[model samples]
Every structure is written in structure tokens, then in C-alpha cells.
Target: MSDTKDSDSDSGTGRCAGCMESTSEKFRGFLNFLWNPEEKTVLGRGGKSWGRILIFYLFYYAFLAALFAVSITIVLGTLDPNEPRFQTRLQAPGLSIQPKLDASIKRTSDVIFTAGQADTYTQYTNTLTEFLKPYKENQATLNNCTNGKVKINQQYSMEKPPPSCRFDLADLGPCRNEPYGYDVGRPCIFVKVNRIIKWYPVGFTDLSKAVGNADSNAPPLKDVLMARNRAYDPNRMYVSCYDVTSGNQTYLNTAAGVSANTMYYPEDNGIPFKYFPYYGAFLQKDYMTPLVAVQFNKVTRNVDVRVRCKAYALNIQDNERMRIGYFTFTLRVNE
Candidate 1:
């Protein structure tokens, strides 16, 4: 009985050892098949099959990369670096003003400041100072085009660049002063016509008659032309600013009374014809946009006065919402 039990135990131990060895051998075979299989295969794929797949994918990706590069090159080749491909919005250039309020202040074209406080008005003066810096520097080097005649450059070239007219900073007169009138109640707002490539303004031959027939929103031509020591020119693009606090009625709010006391730098209240037909920044590197500084001499203190400035020309359109040739801003001078 003892011998029989011992033999049975020995037989059972031998069977268990054989089972473990079979499992180990199977695991080794699976690992070998994953790395390098028999019949010269790797991961169940023959060497030729693996090479074929790699070559196929390499050529496919290479073709896709080449196609993408060619598409980009073709698109870029057709575009001109100097000129914009589309200029739909530039048909009638808009108008912009400087000494604008800081972006942090959420105001819609409002210049609000205390006359006596430096912090309130310093930002305004600083803005004007920086904006006029380039004009001051490049004044001497620019071409002095004839005042009444338009400067036209039909053809542009690398050798002979387009002509750029000199916009002398001194011409800004009182507005060019260090304080810029912000210290006092008076404030000088610089108005500039938006630059449109190769677009020149065609001035009204007959100023009085043109104003009479112009859009209802047009600035009063009679009041604009009657500026003190006025320098009126029929061939130049004119700018006029008037208080519109009470509906469409245009007048300057003054201590004396409602009158046209607003003043423009250059005495003419107009931009000379010589500065028109801007040849873009690329062709005319040092080109300066002509400015008309509108000075509000006495704009009733502590009141939000609505003011609208318009640029008059035959080609320019009067669209307040679109800001084609006019811009409206609020001015408030605090004590």
C-alpha cells in the first residue's frame, strides 16, 4: 500500500512538470514569431512584403508632399507682393482722426478730458506728437509738388520710385505747438483722408454750386469757405467741421453765440491737390498722408458736443454709417 501511494505521487509530479515545460515552450515560440518568424518572416510578414509596403507608403507620402508644395507655390506666384489682389472697399476712401481716445476707454469716437488736468489730456497730446514725428523728419527730403496741380505717377518702377509730396509739420500752425491746446480748453483734432492706392480726388470746379447740390449730410460749404484769413482753393480737397449737437444744424458752440468759429490749419481748410493719387507704401516708402488740423476754439465747456467733419470732392461719397468721406465724434471739455 505504501509503495503504491509513493508511485502515484511520483507520476503526478512528472505530469505537472511536463505541463509547465510545454507552456514555457509555447510562450517562447510566440515571442520568436513576433520578433522574427520562420520562413524568413517578421511579425508574420515576409521580407519582400514588408519592403513592398514601406516603398509604397514612402512614394505615396512623397507624392502628397510634392502636391501640397506645388499648390502653395502656384497660389503665391499669382499674387503681387506690392499691390493687394482685391480693393473692393477702397473705391471711396474713408476718413480718420488722430488724438483719438485710448482703446481702454470704451467710448465711441469721444475725446473727453479735463482741460486743467494733465493726466486727462496728456494722452491726447502724446498721440499727436508721435503721429507728427515722421512728417517732421521726412519734410526736408520729400518732393515739393506744385500746390494746385495734382501729382500723378501712372507708372511705378524699382529704379524710379513714385513721387511723394512733402507734408510740412510747420503747416499745422497752432496745432503743431507743444501743448496742442489740450492744456487749455481748446483741442486740436487732426483729420486725415484714408489712403487708397492709385486713387486721386477730383475737386469741385465750382465750390458754391457743388455744395448746394451735394448730399444733405454734406458740411455747409458757405461756412467752410468763409474761414477767417481763409485760403480757399477750387482745386483742393476741403474739410469742414461743425457742431451737430442739435440735429443736422451745423454751427460751432462758442461763448459769444452759435457761429462758425472752428479753425483749420493751413488756413485753407483744404488738402492740396499735389498730395493726392497716393502710390501705396511699397512704391512711396516715405509717403505721408496730408492732414487738416481742426481746432475747436470755444466748444462750450462741460458739454458733450457732437461734431461731424466732411471731406468734399466729386469722387468722394457721403455715407456716415460707412464712413466713406465723413466721420462724427463727440468732444467734451471739462473744467
Candidate 2:
């Protein structure tokens, strides 16, 4: 009876231990099969399974690549190369002031200059040259354009061949001189109206009378005194410049000494009406914005003069942020 009891206890203990070891072996075998691809059997599958997986991933990646290419093609088809598709938010384009930088300053919205600084003045003048590069006139492009106004009434005409008004850069006159009037403390401020399709100025009629009626506190529009000689156009836009700081009595006395004169290129008052209804780049590839150069003649050395230029139009609107129809900059000719 004792021998039988001892035998039974040994058997019970040994069986439990043996079962545990078997389970551990099975688990280790499963891990080796998953971890080692070099092993004959893997994930309970034949060698063909490995080849199948590689083929599956190759097809999957190729399909994803093809889908991406198609998506890009669709997006490009919707875009217009010449004009923006959506312009409702920016109904009126802003006025651009050029030469608004120096060599040290890569880009800026305001201008800073020093009298007798030829290097700084030259740098600014070069910028103007580059800006006008697109508008570089040649015989081929000017075939349809003439000295007078050219208008396009049909979309098909724009498609067939559009017309552009001749804007001879020579009209810049004294402002376009070497050093650009910087040597004599007279810096040229180039103003351009941003391009917007089918937009026309409303308050351009009798610009001389309108300029004459400028704010009494501001300096007189002495430039308009010569308007009597030139033929004024009702369809063109008008520009006005004033000393915004003239409101202060102390500043006004000092500001009066600086002669600020407005000189419009191609014509006086504003950009010509002939350059209107800007078609897309496809129609007018060499199109450029109508520009006005205001020469601040006799700016006092070492004085900080703040000036503002505004475009007047009955239909055109103005914004407080200087984003549309207006811009302000400081002109300091420090020696």
C-alpha cells in the first residue's frame, strides 16, 4: 500500500511539470517561425506565401502612386495661368509703390534715402529697370497699338488678338535721370495702379478743378497749375499727394519748404483709359501697370517728410489699411 501511494504522488507532480515544458516549447517554436524568414516553414505557410506577400505590396504601392498622379492632373486643370479664378474678396487691386527698398533691405513697402548717397540711389533705380523689363516695348508687340486709344469689346477679340496702348517710358522725363534726382535731394517716387479687369475710374472728370479743391490745410497742388496746357481725359484716373503730417502747425512750416511735385507718365492726371479692361496674360503678354512718378523736388536734407499718395475714382473704393487706392511713405534725405 505504501509503494502504491508514493508512485501515485510522483506521477501527479511529474505530469504537471512535463505539460508546462511542452507548452513553452510550442510557444518558442511559433516565435522562431515568425521571426526567421530563412527558416523553411513560416507563419504555417509554404515558401510561396513569401513571394505572394512581396507581389501584394508592390501592386499596392503602384496603385497608390497612380491615384496621386491622377489627383494632381485634375487640380492643375482647374487653374487659370493668366488670371486668378477667385477675385471677389480682392475686388479692387492695391496701389504699388516701387523702389521701396535698398541693397541691404531685400524687400520693403516703404522707402528710405540719404542725400549724396549715390550707391543707395543707384540700387533703387536698378530696381525700377527690372520692374519695367516685362513692358520692354518692341516692334512685334506694338503692331496693333497706336498713339491713340485702343479698345476690345469681345472675348473672341481677346482670343484672336488684343490691343495695348503705347506707354513710352521716356515720359518719365527728369525723374528718369541718372541717380534719379537723389543727388539733388529730389527723389522720384514711382506709383502704379494695380491691374484689375474691366474696372474704370469714375471721379476723373475735371481733375484740375478737383485737385484745386484739395484740403486747404494741405499744400497747394502746384503741379496742376500746368494742367491748362495739356488735354485732360475724362476716362483716365487721377492721383493726389499731400503731407499727412501737415495737420500739425509745427510740421507744416517746415514741410512747406520741401517742393513735392507730381509728374504723370504717358499723360498728366492718371493712367490712360486706353489701358483699361486688362485681359489675361494670354491676350496681353507684355502688359504692365500704369505708373506715375512723383518727384519730391527740393526735399530738405536731414528732415523726415511723410507723404501720402491717393488715387481718386468715383467707382473705386478705399480701405483704411492702405491696401487699396492709397499708400503712405516717409522721405528722409539725410546727409
Which candidate's lDDT is highest?
A: 1
C-alpha local distance difference test of each model:
0.78, 0.63
Which sections of candidate 1 miss by over 4 Å?
1-51, 101-109, 208-216, 227-232, 248-252, 255-258
lDDT of 1 at 46: 88
Task: Write model 1 residue lDDT over 143-163, tens digit each, in one string.
Answer: 887766776646677678878
| TM-score attained by model 2 | 0.70
Angstrom error of the Cα, residue 30, model 2: value is: 12
Error of 1 at 105 (Å): 7.2
Against the true structure, candidate 1 reaches a TM-score of 0.79
Best by TM-score: 1
lDDT of 2 by residue, 162-258 (tens): 6655566677777655567777667776788887765545544444444322322233233442432454556666665556654532231243432
- Minimum summed lDDT over a 10-residue window in model 2 is located at 212-221
